[model samples]
Target chain A: MENACCIVGLGAISSIGLDVEENYESLQSLQSGISYPEFLQTLHKTDLPVCEIKKSDAELAALCKMPLGLPRTVYLSAIAVQQTLAVIANHDMSKLRIGFISGNTIGGMDRSEYFFTDYLQNQSQGQLQDIRYHECGSITELVAKHFGIKHFVTTINTACSSSANAMIHASRLLKNNKLDIVIAGGADALCRFTLNGFNTLMILDSEPSKPFDENRKGLNLGEGAAYLMLTSEAIRSEYNLHKYATLSGYANANDAFHQTASSAEGNGNYQAMKEALAMTGLTTSDIHYINAHGTGTGNNDASEGIAIQRLFGENIPPVSSTKANTGHTLGACGALEAVYACLGLRDQVIFPNLRFETQMKDLHFSPDTKWQATKNMQHIMSNSFGFGGNCTSLIFSKDS
Target chain B: MGVYIQGIGNISAQIFDPRSQDFTLHAGHGNRLICIEPDYKDMIPPMQLRRMSKIVRMGIACAKAAMQDAGIVKPDTISLGTAYGCLADTEFFLQKLITQDESMLTPTAFIQSTHNTVSGQIALLLNCTGHNFTYVHRGHSFETTLQEAFMLTQENVNCNALIGGIDELTNNAFNIISRFGTYKKEDEHFNNEGKGCIAGEGANLFVVNAKDTKSSYAYCSDIHVCSTENIAEELDGFLHVNQLQASDIDTCLLGLNGDERYDTIIANNIRNVKNARTISFKKYCGEYPSSGAFAMALACKLLQSNTTPMNLQDLNAPLNDEPAQRVLIYNHYKNQYHSFILLNRL
Candidate 1:
């Protein structure tokens, strides 16, 4: 029998709210985190709408209780990590053997960019330390240190699919008996580096992102972090822990069709979903809802819609893209959506896919744009597709 | 439960292949740092070559060579582990962003900057749309990739998997890391002199399979990764789990860069293994986050040759035996991450 990996705790901070509860409440009320850029100073500030966190660097650092002068990304990640750790307080810190895996595309880039111009002039001496935080692993190291975790630690940087891949790696390690407990998720803070990068790609939507809509322009770049505490069933049972949801199946596949674009038919996304379903031994009928990867971009929504249509046939499950609320959190979207899936299973509710309107002419399906509470929700699938044709699908189910 | 390395291909600073039999060690670029990249035109087609960066070229070359070595036309899965994926492309895109102010930036460079580009490109090249994933966790990146491959093989998901670690050197990257004191500056160059062990890059590919072939060099017994500030305790625990004592290891592959501060951790770890002869590869391969892959490739070659190269030998200890049966490879990057990989002759 496959060992069940259970999520004991979940924490999230996005443009919507600070924790899971607040975010859920906002989702229920149709509150959009999307707004005109205020925190990030960029050339496209007037043109782009982002789902940015309300906290400042100093405020976030204080909330995380981190040392001063830390990178913004680390500060935000520590906040979410500490919140998740608070729930599993009873678990032994010394003998638990916890591992940490994070996903981030731009780690400490906000700080690094500040130091970049100054360092070039050889005028700043202390700023050189900021360069250490440029690598993706540095923030993960900082988070691990905050919790005193010494076991396996890693950072995944496959763009949008980073956190989804991180979650998959964590679950796989738990199943292989490599780790007893693991905290896996991702964080990406807003900065001119990322904002400008997306702007240059011409994928930043001026208005609110409309995922799977015919008139969708592009994505709204958002920022924040989310993480889950995953442990083997044996550990959970031994500790008498409350399970949030079970990570039933996950699969990662490469599109190999383009460097940044998905295949014309979404081959990689389809294969990943198929394999994830196969791993769980679950039929299409078993899936209750799907949290789509819909970034509101012309390419991603269309590709992911085609993949979803191919997987479930014409009668698709009620699918929705929460990017309307959180924008595209990039690396954190996978874990963020995973947390949403768990919440769906817990409350027996399907959150509305905000900003979704007319179905695409290329596909014959529409998303559930209205929030509804239903009973007996079983399986929920979440998808995250990234720049390198990296596609990941994770299935979370209620404990039987 | 052991994973066998059926075939291996490596492109490093030293040419250590059976066909070439060229074990000559060449220092990288300046002083003692340089990356020895092969002529990839012979391996990759011209059309693909235009879009390929150094990392991509090196990865494709090594992957093709590994598949050829394993006598397999196509692998069931492709997994790549890279710390900084496609650094050349990343630098190119960053340069365009900074200089051009984000206008008319080529999408090609920006698209290829992702960590999974190597695995995705390899899959495209072969047209085998099997399981493909990439791990980008600093030093432990390659170890985790192999661990996943081992798990998949154990699960019978695929009998054979193509796994490799590839990182490329860039001028801007070196300059940036040098400013951070991670790499040795020219003024403080005397301490890091003679051994020009700075950040260098190349690719090392391996074909790991459930079926043990007669040509297998070694079987991977186990692997571990830890992020503890205390190295000694982690080492002891890792050794204890394998029912191994430090003295039982016949050889130790240490990732001792010429850096004074970071090399101490490696030296202290080697002190635990009293009876083992220490071997260092960074002096030849230079230093990169995923350089452990190079050390692993060297371990497989040592198993096959039944001999250690003089260039790799540590002057402090002499080889006790002509052929070593067991090897312990320990590597760390800047004291932040550490990994232990155990290999034995099959």
Candidate 2:
């Protein structure tokens, strides 16, 4: 890992905790953020348990100086990015050409759902500026403008694998010497559009999700934001930035089998993982931990487990799905789990996979249910598979 | 490494079918420039075609046509850009969720509602297991996809990447956006009432590889994406890096949506590059965030034909006496995301 793009700072606002340190503490303490929704204004709030941030929109809005009527997605992004910038407060701001590569699925649909409903009822009832942030890049543009990061700004929306692809591009930009500093991550807040969308898909587990379990019913949806500050060797040396971990390799592949469901053999997942490991020239023995994209759905867990068994054979590392804790953050899970992986590297510990009892009947390996600390925490892999069969995998290793 | 645009596919507000040798030039006559729908029954099976929205069908059709023109079976990679992805589905799902109290909602619309649906579906149809990417950076979406494609082709000259941009408007979306003053009223046009512009959308794609073939229309030399504050200076640096001067550019395509407020940005930025002939492609494709794809398709066509369409012929425009060998496409979204693309005649 010579002159790799190092993770200098991390900012996360998830159900587990509101900031990087809190999130790390929650991971170490094995505290689950899967609780009833407090802020989301959906009818299923009473029936479904979600890992939602406890702050109301107004409370979260007061955290930052944003204009009124912006979507909750923008608020979450601002909170995470604010913390990301705060982590690198000592960096020479004027000298740095910062690039904000944010990933989001539904930009302001949380607000748009409200606006459009009002508009449907009465065309003139909704505020004019509310629906303006409906597009996916709208939040990225707003956050970039707020942070004054104009050098290289972009947004990726590959469903669940979005933030993983965002990190892939961010690392590539740094490796290509396009930007000095890259803030790469994603943010997605819960809205009726996504909630009912998943509900219609009939994958929303009413109870806590158990990944890699045989009877795993479905996924418990969640909402949050996470960002990692990526800095190259030149910027690292110039600014004397502290490296938390190294983003060594990443790969993206399509299943080409189905739109929402993965292939029966998990072709895309296997290819993504194999290529990512090949990128770093690392073997299965070298990988210390596996942060699986175990969404608790029957199709996803079985397919991902098969992919893992194919890659690792009989020798599998400690595998876990933090979704049991933070729920699936949709697009932000990549960066959220990325921050968790960096924590594993920095602290040399493997977090527990919450609420897992039985292994899937179809697979040889089951996710680690209890928190386990480890000494040889070196290379870690994170997987994020999305709808339309878009799959991505990322590797993080100790900054040598 | 240079990327050669080996093939192009365009389905837009204009009736210029790329499959035909001659293009039927459609002038900028109306504010609501609607895309001339293509017959998908020719390319897609009924099963797949039934579930796809207008944008998804258009994307798949364009991608298939582009691959056919390039003599490639399947692209090694697929990257796409879209301002509003599957908007028809998004709107449908939203309307259902709101009206139906979030119950009894169908998953079909929700499944196709993602921004990457178009690119993912293209790969699925082609069985392309290679790299797949989608960019949603408003105006920079198309340019970012081109940049990703350039890097891929540069990495391996043998690699052929299918990259494109697609955007389609729904009726409710258009109505709401128009009310937000996005589009000029039909009667309000032809006056200095620069408060609104025409609404338009399209799907355009190009097959790019590092090697040139008989189908190569132009060579994509460089692409620059930046903020709109200093477009002139940034474009100068971009051209200088490519060893091209402003005068070296034979044709320049700018996005002038008839909105004096935003179009004036380009006018002021290019006030100095007086020697290059400038034309606005929005007249044909109208205006959309991903309109740069239409502009790129037009550049490929102009470079291949060695002649500008009569509809865009400006007698007083700075037309180079020499044959048009190079073309530049520059566009922005609401005076924010600035993009410049350089294409050279093969």
Q: Write the per-residue lDDT of candidate 2 for residues A1-400, one digit (tens) a residue.
A: 5746889888899998989889888887888788877778888878888889998888778786787678988888889999888767865677677899999999999888878888999776787777888999999999999888899999999999999999998987887777889999999998878888998988989999888888898998888999999988767767787888999988999999998999878999999999999989989999999999988888999899999999999999999988988998998999999999998898888878888887678988777766676786789999999987899999999954
iRMS of candidate 1, Å? 2.6
Q: Model 2, A194: alpha-carbon shift in Å?
A: 0.6
| Off by more than 4 A, model 2 | B17-23, B188-193, B319-322
TM-score of chain B, candidate 1?
Answer: 0.92
Q: Residue by residue across B1-346, what tens digits does model 1's lDDT show?
A: 7688877778887776833334566544443355567777788889989888888888888998888988888888887888877777765666566566556665677677777778878888887677777777777778877888878889783578998787887776777766555666554332354423466787899998877778887888888776566677878888898898888888888888877677766888667787888887787677888888888888887777756666657878656546667888889877767788899876
C-alpha lDDT of residue B241 in model 2: 94
lDDT of 2 at B292: 93
Predicted structure with the largest TM-score when compared to the true one: 2
Docking class of 2: medium
Q: Which docking class does model 1 fall in?
A: medium
TM-score of each: 0.94, 0.97
What stretches of model 1 exceed 4 Å from their correct place?
A119-126, B18-22, B27-32, B185-197, B227-240, B244-247
Going through the candidates in order, state the TM-score of chain A alone for each one: 0.97, 0.97
Error of 1 at A24 (Å): 0.4
DockQ of 2: 0.79
- In model 1, the Cα lDDT at residue A287 comes to 93
Candidate 2, residues B15-105, lDDT tens digits: the string is 6655344656675565778899877898999998998899999999999989998999999999999978889999999998989887888
